[model samples]
Each structure stands twice: as C-alpha cells, then as structure tokens.
Target: MEKIATIGLDIAKSVFQVHGVDAAGEVVVRKRLSRARVIPFFAKLPRCLVGIEACSNSHHWARELIALGHDVRLMPAQYAKPYVKRGKNDAADAEAICEAVSALWLKKTRKVPLQPRKFLDFCWYQVNFLENNISISGG
Candidate 1:
C-alpha cells in the first residue's frame, strides 16, 4: 500500500468515510469508520494533512485532529462538489474533497495588501464585549 500523504474525510451522523492518497496522487486508502472508531483509526497513522467538509460539527473534529498533531482544514462542501466524479455518495464526496485539497496545496499563493478596518473592528468587539458581560457592582 502506498504511504498516505493526505486524507479527505466525509463526516456524517454515524458513519464517517475517509479517502487517502499518496504523494504521487494515487489512492491509498478508502474506508468507512463509525463515530466511535474515527479517533482510534487516525491515531495510529503518521501525521498528515486532513481535509474535511465544513458542517455543523466540523470545527470540533478539526480541533481533535489538530490535538493529535494532524494538520486539518475545513473546506466548504460546495467547493469540493465540482471535483466529484461519477455520482454523489460518501466515497465520491471524499474523493472530491481530496482532489480539491490537492489543488489548493499545489497552487502558488501571492501576498496581497490588506485593507485597514481598525475602527470598524474595534467597535464590533467593544459592542460584543459589553453585550456579553453583566455589570455586577459599578461604583
């Protein structure tokens, strides 16, 4: 079996599907894991980049994987859809995510000048802080 360099994970309510690929872009692994088995399965593998479709609990999974030393990215489902091959299924979705992730890593990035919005951001933070905090004793 080829050494897995990257993995695309398709998360669902109970069953989670994973599609892995080697550095040469060949499929290395394709398996279904239960919710209970996801962590143990990934724990045994060497550190690698993992791509996940952004959904309700994706952030939680990303955090867990990161804690295990895996670099994880949350990609929007719509972004991965165009790369899907034949049909729509968990496996297909995983494959699509892998393809999309591969493309993202292979592309060159350029530094762009960021627009300044200091005042706007400061006001937003101030408003949120005030709203979330309760004034107990004010002198």
Candidate 2:
C-alpha cells in the first residue's frame, strides 16, 4: 500500500468521508468512517497532513487530529468548492478538499491557527449584536 501523504476529511453529524493521496498526488485511500471511529482510524496511520472544510465542528476535529501529530489545515468551504469536479457529495467534497489543500494556491493563503480566544470573541460579539438587535426591535 502506498503511504498517504495528505488526507481530506469531510465531516458531518454522523458519517465522515476520507480521501487520501500519496506524495505524487495519486489517490490511495477513499472510505467512510463513523464519528466514533475517526480518531482511532487516524491514530493508527502514520502521521500525515489532513485537510478539513471550515465549519462549526472543524476546529474541534482539527485540534484532535493535531494532538495525534498530523498536520491539519482548515480551508474555507468556498476555497474547496472550486476543486470539486463532480456532483456534490461527501466523498466528492472530501476529494476536492484534498486537491485544494495540496494545490499551490493553498500555500499563498494564511493558515488558520485555531485560537480559543478568537473564537470566544467572535461568539461574544455575535451574542451582543443579537441582543442589541432584539432590544431595538422589541422582539
């Protein structure tokens, strides 16, 4: 079996799709894993780069993967969308993310360094904005 150099993971509520490629960009692994098995699966593989579409749960997963020694990158969904060559599906999306993450363009953008303080600030700002809007609307 070829050693996986990069992996794209499309995570959802229950199931997750994985797309892996070797250093030469050839697909090596494509499969679906349940939420409970994600960590265990990655734990067994040699450390590799993992790409995940930016979403609510992405940061959580990114931290988890990073803890296991894999380099994890979070690319905005829009960035990954352009790489999708087929219909919209978890598998296809995962493949797209893999390609997008490994593309040269990805190197040009600033990597998302997940920070708890930043996330908290954003959440607090949202809550304050919503509260102010509700009071003004009397709703």
Q: Give the best candidate by TM-score.
A: 2
- Report the number of the highest-lDDT candidate: 2
RMSD per model, one decimal:
6.9, 7.0
Model 2 lDDT per residue over 40-75, tens place: 999998999899998898889998888788989988
- Report the error of model 2 at residue 102, Å: 0.3
Sequence-dependent TM-score of model 2: 0.79
Candidate 2: residue pairs that collide: none
Worst 10 residues of 1 by lDDT: 107-116
Query: Residue 69's C-alpha lDDT in candidate 1?
Result: 77
What TM-score does each of the candidates earn? 0.76, 0.79
lDDT of 1 by residue, 46-135 (tens): 998888888898878887787777877777787788899988899999998888877856343221112225777977887887899944
lDDT per model, in order?
0.82, 0.89
